[model samples]
Target: MPLFFLSYSHVPVHRAGRSPDFDRLVFRFFEDLCGHLAAAGGPEGNAAGFVERPGTPAEETLRALADCRVFVPLYAKRYFTDPKCGRHWTAATTGPADTRPAVVPVLWTPYPPAALPRAAQYDLPAMPGDGDEAEEEYAATGLHQMLQLGEELGDGRAGRITAWLARRVLYAAATVPAPPGDRHVPGPLTALDNAFTAPLPAPPTLRITVLAPTEEQLPIGRDESRYGPAAEDWRPYGPALGPLADQVRALARNLGFTPDLVAFDKPRAELRGTAVPDAPWVLVVDPWALENPRVADQVREFDAVRRPWTAVLSVLPEDDPQTKERSERLTRLLHTCFPRFLREGRAGEQNAVRGLPDADVFALWFSELAESARMRYLRYIHSQLSAGGDGTGDRTEGRP
Candidate 1:
């Protein structure tokens, strides 16, 4: 049986996209915590872990809860509202008095302590950056204090938290006499009924669909002699829309929006079925891909959707007379499909020319595209809202 029973809500909370640095930090802490426990010299040390299988039978979850040394609930607003989380909480607290699992609450998100259920209102250790910085600092200090207790407990915030929890589990196992092996099943819990039954809040968002060329449309060429030999010989040599898609997704997240990426190779019928008519789209097109009849036909069908969208036509930095001629011809072909498509301009041109292989340049290009799409989306929302004769309008009808 695991020593620690960790519970957290799986539902994602709506927040304006910021750097995912904090998310990464929390994940690292969990990883380090597990590592610390495994390294701790004891038979039970290796057994120290948490189960997070969602949709498991209630009896199975309760059995796990019953067997644990400590129950660590990562509390947030959503945790209180989720029925499954509530069930877990109930199972931990409602058993025989002697057998009840020791609760360790971690403030994963800021929520009023006073408003929490009476059973969960005890003095508890909280995770960092939820509300109180002082509490986190104290928790960190306590962890470092444990280092003297054992060499396995290393240095760092993650180490400190892990050690602290491990100490708690060990202490509980030693001092708190185990209840009878026979268990009394808990009755249904109603403390969180209001939260569970309440309507969920609508998330604020602007949807953006990204259309990218598939590998077949722009195959990797083995010969690098034609495009001037590089480190690797691959046609359209360089990171494709993958990096650009990541950048777009990050930017959209930051802007309080969600982005959906659609491959160009998908059939037109499939595209239309899933396409959101009101949402703005971004198409990352390769000039060479336009030359293919199949690809051109796909582009034409995509344009027929009649949605507000932006197209980014990629170009190579190296310019010879032959390359320039080919680029010009490609530009003309794209114009037939996307009359106002954005293209890289020369130094003398009004628009700034963006080139691949330069991180800063690519970032700027992505920012511009994202900002433009955001503005267009906002306008679309405003128009819809105005037409509805109310600032708050239901825009989900036509959305995919």
Candidate 2:
């Protein structure tokens, strides 16, 4: 059984939503790592067992750290500089610098090396999202070096480092011997035969309706191979249609729901346009036609025959007031000028992150839409019903 020590800075106090997201991401990563380890033989037929303890100085926390075979640090902007973070860093690196119980550091953001005051051995890359070309180039080189280090550390190094988790960390919680002087050492949940089991929740069915102008405005093309050109096009599909179908398909497999997709097109020449059907959930992409304005004429034609639907506009962040004014104007048009709608814009600078050069900003924007749609749909399905008897339940789902 390998003992891993995980540490990070205290959760930010500003955002209430961020804490849950932060904790969920961390725990999910651990779960994924364990699954990978179970595929290997490291954890004695059982997956890696772990005891997730938050950062604390309690006796229990100390005992676990003393026995930890690996030290993992969650490297963020404030983590290396914070006093609490500094103490953990010192303990992990000192007293046994030569020993390889696997010390790993995972960066939350691309921080500059100059910012690191804790230990000088590690070299951080230039911060991404700074929108500096020279900094980005420097960051890319550092990222490559970090990946190489991770490859070198192998599985034995389960520190907070990105390289530490290059493979996966497995634990045999069942194999953990009871600590000396203790009546019983609590084993992994697997020891009780309940570790890997989760009661399947009955997945509620949710409808995802796309209220786009027409097929011409947002084309749906498939590839010969499941993963050819069509697959590539699908990356940008979220801007038009949210990931409700994909999410419904994935979640319903575990729950229950038949996902229905409706597209507004000039289906019949006799019928002027399509009328919006009563759907529990309706998503309006490009609500204001900000990204592509050429399709605005078609959108107007569709809106001539409108139904009560939630609208969301995607905006481009601009540093200048003029561009910002233009973005706000379009967003306001979709909100007040249209029906129930919300507008969302992203920082243009996010596209210029140094470390993630291979990752395109436009691609990421689409990805965010897809992911947000999936999560929003899940919440919508679980909410109470609306008085209108529209399948919307209590969950009024609309995300920009």
Q: What is the C-alpha RMSD of each candidate to the true structure, in Å?
A: 19.1, 19.6
User: lDDT for each of the candidates?
Assistant: 0.48, 0.36
Candidate 2 off by > 4 Å: 12-21, 44-57, 96-100, 118-120, 123-400
Q: Candidate 2 lDDT (Cα, whole model)?
A: 0.36
In order of appearance, the predictions have TM-scores of 0.36, 0.31
Cα lDDT tens digits for candidate 1, 273-346? 63334444555554555676776777766655534433343433342334354656665656665532322221
Per-residue lDDT of model 2, residues 1-400, tens digit only? 3345666666555654656554554554455455555544444222143434455335454445445555556556656555555555444333322232344444544543323442422222212233344233323333323334444765222223322242322221222232233222233212222211233333333343333323333323321111122211221233333332353344423323344544434221212534322223333343323234545544544344332222222333232233344555555444443331221222332221111111134334333333333333333322323334553221121111
lDDT at 348 for candidate 2? 30
Counting clashing residue pairs in each candidate, in order, gives 3, 22
TM-score of model 1 vs. true structure: 0.36
Cα error of candidate 1 at position 286, Å = 71
Off by over 4 Å in 1: 12-31, 42-46, 54-59, 126-155, 184-400
